[model samples]
Target: MNLVFLYGPPAAGKYTIGRELASLTGLALFHNHLVVDSVAAVFPFGTPAFRRLREQFWMDVFEAACAEDRSLIFTFQPEGSVAPDFADRVRQMVTKAGGTILFVYLTLSHEEQVQRVANADRGKFGKLRSVDLLQSLQADFEACERAMPPPDLTIDTGTTEPSESAHRICALMRDHGLAR
Candidate 1:
């Protein structure tokens, strides 16, 4: 039950590369939008109810997967300048399950992030599709990155194609004896 946690700002290519990594490594990809979109379907975004529901759903999935001893690739964008307790929680779960965790942070230039956010071809999840919304979120992302702990690996999506990034991640996993 290994956990590969890929996190960064939205449109940083976490989901895009995660899909490729999962396909290559045979791990389940659980992007943040999987829970976000489901909860957003019933409740308005940013409401307390929506927040609680989203967390509950994420925990449920993580718990179930850990219990089953399954490897997973989880992706998310950490919110502004608060140390991510979620990583600690995941560490505890995987440790209790006798598994290891890997952290991969994806990064992109502000310009590239804006471009990706504006591209409609990206999946229609609960993400902010408007350039205005993304511009605002960019500030939050910068703050989050400053406060977050260094990741095991960092990939710059602005310079790397999704497939190449996935390959690099896979290579790192293998080097760390985490390859499945």
Candidate 2:
């Protein structure tokens, strides 16, 4: 099993690139919002129920995928202070299951992130759509990045096309001998 963990601030094109990566690599896509939106549908965000259910659901999916030796691409937001250990635990789980994890960080200029927040497509996934909220989140993500270990690969979506970014990520996986 192989897990491609792609993370970045809102509007950093994580999902866009993940989709392309999955299409190219045949890895399953498990973007963050799938669980977020589902859990939010029942429990409110940040509530105890939401947190517990979200964590449990994520764990179950990951464990199942690892056990099945499935390769996957997962997109996430940088969770520096809020959930610093989350990614580490996931990595441990994957390695324990004899799987490889590749961390990819996607980013772009803050100005572009802010501008992209209001795109109609974002709302389709219940994504953050406010410029102010995006700015705040990006600051937090920056701090998180400084505290976290560097990713296996980093792409600037503002300069690179999504397809190109995906290709770079796929290349990294191939170089690591995790993909064909």
- Candidate 2 local lDDT, 148-180, one digit each (tens): 546999899999999999999989999999878
Query: Which residue runs does candidate 2 get wrong by more than 4 Å?
Result: 80-82
lDDT value for model 2: 0.87
**Cα error, candidate 2, residue 13 (Å):** 0.5
**Superposed Cα deviation of residue 36, candidate 2 (Å):** 0.2
Clashing residue pairs for model 1: none
Task: Report each candidate's C-alpha RMSD, comma-separated, in the order given.
Answer: 1.9, 1.5
Deviating ranges (above 4 Å) for candidate 1: 80-83
